[model samples]
Target: MLSGKTLVVAAGIFLLGLVSFGEAIMGGSEAAAHSRPYMASIQAVEGDAMKHECGGFAVADQWLMTAVHCLPAGPNGRKVVLGVHSLSQAEDTKQTFDILELHNHPQFNPDNYDNDIALIKLDRPFNSTEAVKAVAFLRAGGVNPDTNAEVETAGWGSLDNLGNRPDALHEASMGVVSSTRCGRSDYFGRKFTGNMICAHKLCPDPCDGPHRIVDSCDGDSGGPLLYNGVAVGITSNGGKKCGQVKKPGIYTIISHYTEWIDGVMGLQPDA
Candidate 1:
């Protein structure tokens, strides 16, 4: 498939969601530490770097994980800058590392977005911080997360659909939806095989936040999903509009891709 040079949403039974035919991404949470999603920066780019591309998280001391679509290639020498409060420039004290290699799931199908996950291996280990820490990556093992469970999403996308991708990270809260309401039919593949999950507010008219924090939109793809401080999923793709009741937000189930991530990283995803 031709790279659209960009990507990342929604769906309906409830009239709010994470449906694929709609967009299906997920997010991670960190608290006042996570009022919004923060970004990692590249120390210095040769040229055309301002294009800077999509934002990702440091899942490991040396590794930065992001959506496969954001980086079609370039595992070697790729820079993973952490604790960046903004995108303006690189500074000291922010943990930095070099990308020694990259591992994007081999079956990744940009069209259907199957196996939509990637792992970045850093050249060396860096320090961790409360503002920026390693999120727990779970095995999922195809187990359904309990409904009404609180989940959080973090990204650098537009607070609103009509805006630009924020230079810094932003966050929002959602609840895991019951599989029954997601329109499961024999035709939709095995219940959890689609490798996607839905999480949202029980009611979606949407609540206002103090800093005025909003949700995932264009440019928020490949962000993290946090449940009780564990990183469980990544932003896959959601539809165009957001913060509505009818459109359910979809996420690439992280637990479902343990083997692939581990294989690429040369470490066991479950270990």
Candidate 2:
């Protein structure tokens, strides 16, 4: 489970350095309505308002996959927004569900971001539609994608490390980074566990200081890191600053935890 102490410390630094923050699709463009149908917004409801806390994707009729860190510390009215591209708009394509349960990984180590995955069970199942669908998973024994392969992610996180959240859903393209490079001492160091996957942009960004690369920023955590329309990773953590070229965003490797996910979802292991 995510430790409150760890988050408090990280949040303090995030406020001070103006560094790149949480898992938001920092460098991406606006995603079209229902184009990424599997995307879901995890929201914490306070009174009449719903605050977006993290991103997630539907995997079953009533189940969603997200990062454990996104789970609220205390009881709250948790809900999910689905099939909507604009946060403010109540379009016909939009759907909402109350979260009935949260299953955080038993061994999730918030201190080092190990096993930063979780599942959300909805009060009711959603009907399949043009704007709402479950995402595909990487097949059993499927070939692992090579490092530097192009992949996409979508979210409604901050436009920049310290910027306000966008009203529209955003999408960005990034490249997979090898475990060797991601584990470098100068980078994530010992924190980059093998269970995690890292990814970032291959090009440079002048806006993020020096030659920093584009990446997922705050608010994008729990979102899907996709390749060829299949979910391969879940957004987890990132560098000290958002979009630091060398500090690519880290994600929970979905393929590595398929069995556990299947167990939680009551699905066949070979499904």
True-vs-predicted CA distance for residue 6, candidate 2, Å: 43
Worst lDDT run of 10 residues, candidate 1, spans 20-29
Regions of model 2 farther than 4 Å from truth: 1-26, 72-75, 204-212
The RMSD (Cα, Å) of candidate 1 is 10.0
Cα deviation at 253, candidate 1, in Å, is 1.1
Per-residue alpha-carbon lDDT of model 1 for 1-271, expressed as tens digits?
A: 5344422211233223223212222232323433332345433365766434455767766676777766666543456667655555554546657777777778777775656788777778766654556666677564446777878776656555445455555667878766555535532234333677766663313442212223356666777777776777777654457544444566678888776666666675444
Tell me which residue pairs clash in candidate 2: 20-241, 20-242, 22-217, 22-218, 23-220, 23-221, 24-217, 24-220, 213-245
lDDT tens readout by residue for model 2, 1-271: 7699999998898665444433333456788778999999988876788888899999988999999988836226778989878888778988899888888888899788899989999899998899999998774476556798988888988777556788988888888998899899988889999788898884545233334356887888999999988998899998656776568889888888778888888888662
Instruction: For candidate 1, report its TM-score.
Output: 0.70
Give candidate 1's whole-model lDDT.
Answer: 0.59
lDDT of 2 at 172: 86
